[model samples]
Target chain A: MAFEIHLDNFTGPLDLLLHLIKTNEMDIYDIQMVEITEQYLTVVEQMKQLDLEIAGEFLLMAATLIHIKSRMLLPVSDEPVEEEDEDPRAELVRRLLEYQRYKQAAEALEALPQLERDVFVSRFVPTEIADSADETVSLGVFQLAEAYYRILSEVPAEVFHEVIREPLSVAQYVQLVVRQLADGQRHSFRRLVAAWPSRAELVVTFLAMLELVKMRLVEIDQVADYGDIWLKLRVAQGELAAVDLAEDGFGYG
Target chain B: MADLKRLAEAFIFAAEAPLSFERLCLLLERSRPEVRPLMQELLTEYSAGQRGFYLAEVAGGYQFRTDPDCGIWLRKLSKERPLRFSQAALETLAIIAYRQPMTRAEVEYLRGVDSGGVMKTLLEKNLLKIIGKKDVPGRPLMYGTSRQFLELFGLRSLEDLPTLKEVSALDPELAEAVPLEPESDN
Candidate 1:
């Protein structure tokens, strides 16, 4: 039977294989190896023609399918086959069954009332909780890491003739960031990094941002993926100097 | 009876998050058996009243949300971006939810692709979490769904999940592919 195979329609090779088997209405336990292998190869060829990036795993499955087909072609022994020497398709069948189970489960999940879809919980927060948390916006550490890498790439590679140690600590950077945000306005991460002249200084600045976040002194926000990161001071103006002094003393000691 | 339903509605409406039955009881100073029926009564009343909002039980709690039919209008007003999940991520999440404490290698074997990137995204989103390491040869990390997942999916609990048979019945082709009885240990 002719089946129009679309690589995008299937999650991967096994999904495609399962589709083919189901479309053909062949008993999974009693698969027609020769026919299935031919169909599988055809799908792979189509994938190549379409210039889709066929992962190594797909090719490996193709080889396995061919091997199974070849084994099935060999003459059967007159003596009864041992239980350990099970059907050549046993391993593949087991995997397909396992995958199918999860596939079904996923369908069930999709059918449920998803948040922000079928149902939405109240976005409202009790005033007390909101005040205590101070509505601080934050980005994941991963985003900070990305920002660090971008800044690092901008710095020219250094070939040092002698080891130069700079007395830079995370606390100092925290103070620097707080001073920069003294106006209580938001600052972009790139802007913060741009103020530093050297790669070492940039590193210290990034470390300080991390420290500030840990101390709940600054809030970081990223609106979207790979988007600009914004940082703002969390503490009030009156407490800023006190925080700076405390952090500085802590850093030096 | 009318007074109690209105009170339940007001409580659910003002709450910042889904209000659990226990919390509702505590706030109302009522028993579990007393609060549940009141909530149900409110749910039925809203459905019958054909209001713009309805009472929904999500994340093991009751909350007042806009009716699905009014979703477009709500989106226009809020302008909030809806969450989107890729097909691969959903499938992987499903496997993790059902067969968890599963290893990455096991998920990859079932998926027939390198799921490293997808898994990382799920972890970053706080949908899936590393529960612990499995006691195997390499001691691969085991993953399971996070509480965030339950909340995001609006599931009260894992028990709220539909059976495989029920889900597969939605599609004839899928029903044929998935056996009525799953023999795998997972």
Candidate 2:
């Protein structure tokens, strides 16, 4: 609450929009642009009156609002509206919709069991406490997301040192892996990536295997005991060369 | 017809859950530049007022699913009396998957559940493990997910999951298909 008052001075554009929406109880979809524009302009007026010079960013938003206001004022034609000729509110609506989703996501995150040391310590899972542990031994190695998150926190955010400017791409990593695995040599998963220059490279290389798994590019297995985990390329270099061809067949488009 | 490709249909068919751009590209061996716009175009065209089904990303991969209106049919298909997953299970699973090698006490604290039994079920299901023991006061055991999870869900890897929005978009069928349960299984 204290932060809200202070943030008003340096708040971002979305914050302003949200403020206006809350204050006026404005229906976001059917906003009274003229009224909103008036109030918005008044804020600028107040800032000027207080001798607090404002940035051009707010002014730009004001101008954009004015333009949209004029368009909203325009009369509807008898001819059907083209998809492109829809209300200027469309883009604004899109952003508002997106922000709404983000808001909901943030709320959902709030409800999540925010745990310490990977264990939830809240009154969160009472209903799920029922156990049926009369079963067999299980083998799972579940560290991935948090592992990366920790890695992200520990690594320097900005790598100024020009270790390797070019990213170790998924495609190239796959090639390196396929060749090494094809050479009949067992590659230690831990040892294979030890020489990587930096953390991001390590991440990119890890991501490559993940991509391969998605693409059915390789088979990863861990036999009984703490033996060296194995990853072998599924096919030859020529078969693997169908990178572009994948787009043609299974392309997202 | 040579230039025309039913890429969307193909993606839905192959993916385990709902897929993301990065996952899709890896699956198709394409770059973002070549895949994103085309996927957008295809998504718009395919889902334009369609009723029986919708394309969306969920969990971490894509799959063709029956329509939401047809959820009653799907509900019937699972044949477990629509046994909704327990919140404790979902919470514990999400916690373990997101933050793993955790101890039983750590899970109980986060879930606020005496998760000894649920942990055991997950263990029996081969979905969890005692990834060595912590050298703490009680020397508690740590838990994590198994590779069976990826295989069971038909995912090749964890990177297959899109962001939340993309996941929802990846599987609008399930989005609409869902019942009004208080908590969705994570």
Candidate 3:
């Protein structure tokens, strides 16, 4: 029974060739090169007619098959055969067999009781114990400065200095940081400070971040070595007021 | 006196990831010699096939998994879309799993098709991982099957994979020509 093979139906040319061989029940050990080549070419022609994007590998195999057929057609000499002389079909046959083995292995893997597919494990997850195991290391002053400097380099040098009508206060910047992380998400330290329009405000915000950390109002954590420092609130937004920011002596200007 | 089997069972039951022997020992505060028998007993009890779920020694650890037949009903309840593997994907995965630490070019050579897309899909699925770059001049990144591959396939380890059957009655010379190592093809 003849069948129409689509491009998507087979993985590649060798797979297609195997299918052809299996359908015809041709002996793989002794592949009838002439017959199989004709059948393979016909399939390729059909694929072309259907406008299927036949892979170059298929054409390569087609050429190999024709070459084998032509070699087989050549008259044989009566001279003694050498020890190392190999059949043109030998390499092709070896590859087909090798491919067939893996194809079977793939079938075996498919048949196994796959996790999340044929079988399932318990979805039970215990309530997380307070994660003292948090891998985040406390951000050091040096690392924080390095991160701040990286952000500073990206911001263009200020074109004109504005009059210091109202100096940027550490306390106000402290409140700004608390508000930024009030959503309880880890905001990148560089990204948070980089929002300021000028170098002076950036420096004031950096000092405010240090002030907040000292007062235990916010925590700076580096999740990985040399990774970005993240600023997150140590206390809830309501508790930020209770933290004696005044006691820390960073008075609001 | 703590029933070690019960404690181990509880740990395995509650664990999302497979509970390893080392972790179990640490959790139980028991010596390896003491824990080994209890774990074996637990495994044996589950292996009797009397329970709804059995303890599977997968990915070098123990996990409680329901029978494969129960998946149909489980899928209905959970509505997790079953992971589908295409012919190409399966073949590509098989090649990598067996002859892994090989390159995409090598995989293509075996499958006789471009496998970059297939390998990428497998890598995305976490079944394959880049072990390291091959020491060759181009230093192409080598790929290997991940622990997730074993867990998904219900294999305890790579050693748990079924031994590939020898190709029967093949010429010794032709057999020798089947190069397992990546060779510099001229």
TM-score of each: 0.62, 0.30, 0.66
Q: Candidate 1, residues B1-186: lDDT per residue as tens digits?
A: 457667777878887667788878877878888877887788788662287777767667877766666655566555667777777888899988877888899899889988999999998787887777889898888888876788777667777667655322123458464342222353
Positional deviation of residue A100's Cα in model 1 after best superposition, in angstroms = 2.5
What lDDT score goes with residue A208 in model 1?
A: 79
Candidate 2 per-residue lDDT, tens place, A1-253, comes to: 0011222322334335545554556666777888877767766665676676665656777887899999988887889787768778777656544543443333333333221211111122233332332323332343454457789999888957766465345556655655566654556666667767577767766766666667786777778678656676776667776654232343323
What's the distance in Å from true for residue B32, model 2?
2.6
Docking quality class, candidate 2: incorrect
Better of 1 and 3 by DockQ: 3
Residue clash pairs of candidate 1: A124-B16
Candidate 2 chain B has its poorest 10 consecutive residues by lDDT at: B166-175
Inter-residue clash pairs, candidate 3: none
Query: Model 1 chain A — which ten-residue stretch has the worst lDDT?
Result: A134-143
Q: Rank the candidates by DockQ, best first.
A: 3, 1, 2
Which candidate comes out best when scored by DockQ?
A: 3
**Candidate 3 RMSD to the real structure:** 19.6
Per-residue alpha-carbon lDDT of model 1 for A1-253, expressed as tens digits? Answer: 3445546767877787787777667888888999988989887886888898888888999999999999888888989887757788989887787777777777768766566765554676767776675333334444456669999999999987997778777677777788888899999988988988788888888777877787788899999999988999898988766654455554544
The CAPRI category of model 3 is acceptable
